[model samples]
Target: MSEFLSHSHPRVALIGECMIELQQHANGTLKQSFGGDTLNTAVYLSRLLGSAAQVDYVTALGDDSFSDAMCAIWAEEGIGLSRVQRLPGRLPGLYCIQTDAQGERRFLYWRNEAAVRECFTTPAADPILAALPEYDVLYFSGITLAVLGEVGRARLLSTLGDARDRGARVVFDNNYRPRLWRSVDQARQAYRAVMHEVDLALLTEEDEQALFDYADSEAIMSAYRDMGVSEVVIKRGAQSCLVRADNRRYEVPAHPVHNVIDTTAAGDSFSAGYLARRLRGGSPQEAAEAGHRLASLVIQHPGALIPRSVMPA
Candidate 1:
């Protein structure tokens, strides 16, 4: 675990875009909600940590009813709204999810003009960028990089470097979405830009392979290791997760789930579980176990968020 989180009640900030989610049912009905990669992780992390840590979501949302609803939901989940920004005359992005018989999900997005695209580019963002360094942990994903565009991304990179210089741990999740970028080379360049400041990397094996063209998991791990990341976790759905922490390696098996429903936030929940356990002083192996346990339960549910009542104890 990173030394920044050694203190009790460490503060965490997750930067990304949260969109209006429309879950398409088999009967052609759409169930509306809110979800995003880092947002999903923030909610689950807040739930897992309870009052043990402070989780704040950093993003810009429109001054609309949907945005208001999003804030209400995050507050209910115990996520801090102090870092969230509200912009006028814009709306949050929208996405629709269609699930297959195998519980695999496909998404169609309408986010080109979302308010979060200007999150780190506006004048109001200066204070948020200045305050980010004060947090114990800073978390973001590849999708965040893609959505931030060039200017926003450049500002974010500077903030990340500053945050790291202040002894804060930077956690990166490789939630790659090819549709969000102009080309693979552009995505590669963006991802490589932030690698230097990342303390912990939570990557999906398939996404890593797709993003960097790594032959296998070993190559992916070797690449991040060479990038100077202190901790690396490879999440392979239904298979074992690979972890490299404290110069030690471990392969933790995933929990078995006979029933499959929706695989919306499996990886996000796993990251939340892993970070929650590791930050609370659990071993790497124990953290991976917790990740697997939570992920297995998430995939058995129907949306990005499962009912709080069904959460694991």
Candidate 2:
């Protein structure tokens, strides 16, 4: 195994929000569940690692019943909850997903008042922020940056820097949602602040082009290289994913999925598979393949999380 997972149980902390998800069907009925980028990755990571690693989620939630249900779900998935904060008089975010015939999804969000907006800004978060640097790996996404706002992002940036200085690997998934940011420039600023600390960047090709206006995968890889990121994985839907690691470049093809369903958490699950395999000492090639495998399975399902019973062996 890699030195990062050399211990009996490697500890990983994923920071982001988990919202109340409502899947709208053709009949106009709503199927409610819980999902988020980092949270989805945390759940899949916990499942993939099993007893080999400790995966914790770091975010603030409401003291409402929805938050309770969310915690129960995370606990059942074997994810650590010590870092979760429940604030009084607040509620978790909510969003509705509508999928088309091709399994593409559209979302309508009502998250402005979500408790996670105050994630790293509360007094209770001081200790959590201090403890973050002790983990073996720290993971978050572009959506995480957008939700945390200015104050929270500043605190998270400092914590990430501290974590990297202590030899912990920082993983970033670029899941940019333009609606969440005031402007593209503001989002760019926040992303740049965290990019330098990232050890592995799991970037979606579309998001990169949308966020940075990068002409192609090469430009995206070149930019991260200049920022001193050692490992970069560009996730191109359907096409081969590009991996640049240890001065080597690879093109790992995506797993073929015949029947497409909801594409809600495809990238999140991909990040989880890639990180889980890498932590277990798999090469970049192997890790990317694992990612493709998990993502292929996820996209066939109807929600962000499929039945755990169907998890890949």
Candidate 3:
């Protein structure tokens, strides 16, 4: 159904923040880059779908050198920048990634004062919110909801409703971070409010367990069905991804990886791959395969954005 909602040349708009990323290497050196969950998904989707979709990112950033560089890099990846908001004298958020010997990653964030917290509250956001319904699809994650606060969350809910009414597909990813929200109850309220409006949900099993404390995958799937989500995909790392669509279920196994260098952006890339295939008129099973394939490759390399040259054909 989501695939059928788009025109021949679909326009995809992802709402979230991109932060200054610093990664520690084995040699005790730090490598700088820019990445966020939605941003990573946007880049990979742009690469995979190519001319099939017009991918855009919507977020607020400071008018600083880092922001400028981030925009330029996004443009180089062929992501649209028409919805990006530049707040004066404000800086984008920053985070550091440290990976242990097992390739597991940990992050330390400095984003309390990031400009994206004001994404839908500023004057410039009026146009961005208004323009959201014009896109064929609107993609956002749990983190996007957390940073918006109460006021901005209300604004977002209104916009999402309007967008859905205008025949736009609303896609959500459950990338839950417990530390971002004030309390579990508040987070659950926000998630429940938006769940009813979502057309497709890309959920992680661990996140669902952490947030809603579901007993198992069936419980999570039942919750999503009750929320009126037409399509649901549950991603389990190194395991199978379960897809429920068209009143049928499909389980696709994760692709095998010989070496795991870094686990960063694995789920983000998987969502991108799945969305890219779905937008291109593929079935749920096929989308899951594509997602697993891409994620397997991502974990074999370091950082969020892997080299374009190494992209699978």
Candidate 4:
């Protein structure tokens, strides 16, 4: 299953927020963890690619103890924290996850004032914004766009344009949360504008269905294709994923598990594994299989990050 990719270490950055997460179990006991779409992807990407890539997390957080702990966690996962800012007087956001009997989770957020809100416009952000164009890849999500406010989002979109002009690939994940937006029309407009510069897209069927009311996966894929995204992946939990790249479409099946404990980060880990293979010169089909394999293992775990020793060797 091994393939040779470029020997040089590829630099990749995932742009988003990571918050303190409180997961309430069926017995009413709460387990604390850190979870976010882009953060989860960064962790898994670092783990999967090992030294083959340099993965950095781009965001802002407070100088509080919680922020320090999150940084420690990222360092332990081998993610570069140089681009992360520590703003004084601001704290990271806090959220809770409530899951049903089926392990499907619901998030309740209290992150409106997190320091990452000004990740782009703050005085400290000028250097970070300037450094972004140097990276080889930039990854982010819909939630990242929604939480950053209009000004911050505008700055990020502008940064993406500049980064892409410098040959950086923009990777997008559509992790949409309706509650984070002012209205469906506004969300649509924001997504459309940002996606115009996206080179790759990781889309969830349900999120797309809710955000754009697409008739089917093909419509969504076609829309992204028209927007100039060279590659698109559609993830359907416990079902096959649809991958289209270089004028070829691949239908890759997800690995199924009989017992699903916590569904946290399934998509994130999948993205990591897929990118790992792709960066190593594997075909899109091979990457999708790796994604399914890693995600299948992740959903069985209790938290966003599974023990590194327990991961695939």
lDDT assessment of candidate 1: 0.95
In model 1, the Cα lDDT at residue 191 comes to 98
The better-scoring model by lDDT among 3 and 4 is: 3
Please give me the total number of clashing residue pairs in predicted model 3: 0
- For 1-313, candidate 3 gives per-residue lDDT tens digits of 4454546789999999999999988898999999999999999999998987899999999999999999999999999999999999999999999999888999999999999999999989999999999888999999999988888989999999999998999999999999999999999999999998899999999999999999999999898998899999999999999999977888999998778999999999999999988888888998999999999999999999999998866
Off by over 4 Å in 4: 1-7
TM-score for each candidate, following the candidate numbering: 0.98, 0.98, 0.98, 0.96
TM-score (C-alpha) between model 1 and the true structure: 0.98
C-alpha lDDT score of every prediction, in listed order: 0.95, 0.94, 0.93, 0.89
Instruction: Give a tens-digit lDDT track for model 2, residues 229-278.
Output: 98999999888899998888999999988999989899999999999999
- TM-score computed on alpha carbons, candidate 2: 0.98
Residue lDDT tens for model 1, 29-83: 9999999999999999999999999999999999999999999999999999999
The Cα RMSD in angstroms, rounded to one decimal, for candidate 3 relative to the true structure is: 1.1
Off by over 4 Å in 3: 1-6
| Best prediction by lDDT | 1
Compared with the true structure, model 4 gives a TM-score of 0.96
Q: Which ten residues in a row have the lowest lDDT in candidate 3?
A: 1-10
True-structure RMSD, every candidate: 1.0, 1.2, 1.1, 2.0
Among residues 3 or more apart in sequence or in different chains, the pairs in candidate 1 whose N, CA or C atoms overlap within 3 Å are: none
